[model samples]
Target chain A: MKWQIISSDQALYFHSWDNECVVYNSLSGDTHLLNLTASQILLKLQQSPTEAITLAKLVPPTDQSESHAEHELQIEHLLAELNALNLIEKCQSTINYNPPSCR
Target chain B: MNISTLTLSELGHRLKKAGMFLQTGTFITHLKTSIPSVAEGIRLLYADYPLVEHLDFADFHVSLTYPRNLRRWLKPQIQFLFDGKPPFKPLPADQAFPMLEWGLNWCVSSHANHYLIIHAAVIEKGGYAAVLPAPPGSGKSTLCAALVNRGWRLLSDELALIHIGDGRIVPLPRPISLKNQSIDIIQSYEPDAVISRKISDTMKGTVAHMKPPANSIIRANETAHAGWVIFPKYQSSVPAQLKKLSRSRAFIRIADNAFNYSLLGIKGFETLTGLVDASQCYDFTYSSLENAIETFSALEPPASSK
Candidate 1:
C-alpha cells in the first residue's frame, strides 16, 4: 500500500530538537511531539507518496542488526499510529499485486 | 500619582463613585467596590502602585458587590463583575480581595493575546530575570517571596508575560498569594513581611497575600531579558538540590504551564522555543527557604557597594 501526508502545510510548522520534533497542526490547533522515526516518516511522506515497504526502508533503523522483517513491521506500526493521529493517510493509488519475488 | 498618596477615605470614595484606575506594569485596571475590606486591601497592598488618572483606556473594568437579595444579609457573598457580567460564582464577601486578584489574572490571561503569559513567578537580579514556572503547591510563591525580600526584584508572582516579538518578560508585579501553612511559613521566615488579613475556610484552604516589595512596585515597568527557567518544588526534609533540565523538556514544561499557549497557536510554540533556547533550564527542589534563597542569589553576580 502507498501512503502520503494528509497535508503539506504541516512541514512549515515543524520544529525539532535531537530525536524529537514538535509539530503544530493548524487545522485542529493541536501540537504533537514526534520522535525522530515518526518525524522522518512524515518528512518522507511530505516529499512524495511512496509504497509502504519503501517508506519503511526510508526510516533509519536504530539498530543495524534488526532483520528486514522486523524493520517492515516497525514501519507498519508507525504508519498506523500516524494515521490515527490524522497526520498521514493511505494513498488512493492501487497496489501492484504482482509481487517481485525478491528485492 | 501613586495610591500611597491617597488617604484611605479618598481611596474608598474613588472606588465608590468614579472607580479608581490602578496601574500595574503594562495593564491599567479600573477597580470599583463598596466592600470596605477590598478597599483596605488595596490601601495596604497596592499603596505603591500608580493611580492612572485620565487614562484613555483600561484593560479591565471590574467590580465586587453584594447581590441584591436576601443572601446579601444572610451569609453575605460578593460577586465578581467584569464589564457588568459575572464569570464566576460568588464567594464569601471576605474573600473579595483575593477574588479581585484572581479576576485580574483571568482578565489578563484571557484577553492579553499579544503576550505569551506563563503561569510562573518571575524575579530579576543584576539585569538577569529568572522565570520560575511551577504548579500550585510547589512552594513557588514562598521561594519568590524569599528572593524578592532578599534584594532580587519581583517581576510577577503569578504571570510571566513574555513579549511575542522581542522575548523580553514584561513585569506584572502584584501581591504574592500564600496558602495553607505557607502563609505562616513566609510570615515567620521574614518577620517584617507585610501580609494581608488571612481569610480562612476558602476554596484554597486558608489564604493570605503578601504585599509586593515597594521596590518591585516602583520599578514595575522594567522589563528584563529571559535568563533562566527554573522549575522549583518544595519537598520537606530533602536537601536543597538543583539539577539541569534539558532545553527540550523545559520547553514542554513551560508550554504546559502557559496560560494561552494553545490560544496563540504556532506563535506560542515559537515564542516558547525561543525562550528555552535563550535560557539555562533547571529543576530545583528544596526543603528550606533559606537554602533556596541562597542558591538563587548565587545565580546573580556579586553586588558592588553603592
Candidate 2:
C-alpha cells in the first residue's frame, strides 16, 4: 500500500548529524531521534505519498551481504513502526483496497 | 542602588509595604512579604543584586504570606503567591525562603517562552558557555557551585536560557541550590562559600542556596555562545571521565531536559539544533569535583574563538 504523511500542513522539522537525525513533528509536539535508514525513509515519504518498494530503494543498504527479501522485510517492519507513531499512514486511495499491493 | 546598601530594617519595611524590587540578571522581581525570614534570606543572599526602582516595571510580582484562620495558629504555614494568586500549596512558615526561590523558578519556567529554558547549570570561561544539563541528584548544582568559585562565571545555576534568534545563552545568574549532603560537600569544597541556612524536611530534603559570586552578579547581562553541552553523572568512587556524545544524542537529551521545548514546538527544535551544531557535546561522569573541574578547565576553546 502507498503511504503518506498524516498532515502535510504540520511540517516535520529534521536535523541530521553523523548519520542520525532528530525529527520534530509540529502536530504532535513529539521529538524523535532516528537512525540513518529510518530518517531517509521519512524524508523520502515527506516529499509525497510513496510505495514501500520506493521507500526501500531510497534507504541505503547497511549490510552489503543482505538479500533483497530481507531488505524488503526490514522496510515493512520500519513502516509499521513509523505508522504506529502516526508519522505516516496508508494513502487514502489504498485504505479500503483488498490485498494491499505494497504489502 | 544595590540591595546591600539598605539596612535590614529598611529592607524589611520595604518588603512588608510597597515591595522590594530587585534585579537578578535579565529580570526584575517585585517581591512583597511580611514574613521576616524571607526578607532576611534576601538580605543575606541577594545583597549584591541591584535594587530596581519603584517606578520600573517588574517581570514578576510575588508574595509570601501566612495563611489566614485556624491553620495560621496550628501549623503557621506560608503560601507562595504570584500576581495575587497562590500557585503552590502552603508549606511550613520556616520554609518561606526556599518557597520563594521555587516559586520564582515556576514563574520563569512556565511563562518564559521567548527563550528555550533548559534545566541545566551554565557557566562561562574564555567567553564560551558550557551547559550542564543533568537530572536531579546528578550533583549538577554542586559541580556548578565549585566551578563558579574556581574562576568560572556562572550564567545560571538551574535554568540555561537560550535566545531563539541567535542561539546565544542569556545569563540568568542566581543562587546555586544544594540539597541534602551536597550542601555540606560544597562547604568543605569551598570554605568561603556563602550558602543559606539549611531548611530541612521540607520536600527536597535539606535545601540551601549558595550565594552567587560577586563577579557573576556584576556580569549578569553578558551573554555567551554555547560551546559545549555536557551531561554529567556523579557516581561515588568512579574515576572522572568524559565521553564524546553525538550531536543527535545531545539534541535529544537537551530537549528532554528543556522546560518548554515541546511548548515552543518547531522553534525549540531549530534553537536546539543550532546549539548542538555549535557545541562539542559530551557525557561526563565524575566522582571527584577536583578532577571534573580540572577536565573542564583544560578544555580547548571553540574553533571560532581561535
Q: What is the lDDT of candidate 1?
A: 0.86
TM-score of each: 0.91, 0.95
lDDT of 2 by residue, B108-142 (tens): 89988999999999999988999999999998999
The interface root-mean-square deviation of each model, in the order shown, is 1.7, 0.4
Q: Write the per-residue lDDT of candidate 1 for residues B1-306, one digit (tens) a residue.
A: 789898899899999998989888899888888999988999999988887787779888999999887888888999999999999999998899999998999999999999999999999987778999999999999999889889999999999999999888899999998999888999999999999989999898999999999999888888887888999999989888889887767888888899999899878988888787678889999999888888886674323211
Q: What does DockQ come to for candidate 1? A: 0.42
Q: What lDDT does each candidate get?
A: 0.86, 0.89
Candidate 1, residues A19-100: lDDT per residue as tens digits? 7787777667767778888889888877777777997777877778989889888888989998888788776543554222
Candidate number 2, chain A TM-score: 0.84
- Candidate 2 lDDT over A1-103, as tens digits, reads 6877766676677889999999888888898898888888888887777888877777767888888888888988988988887788887554566333234
TM-score of chain B of 2: 0.98
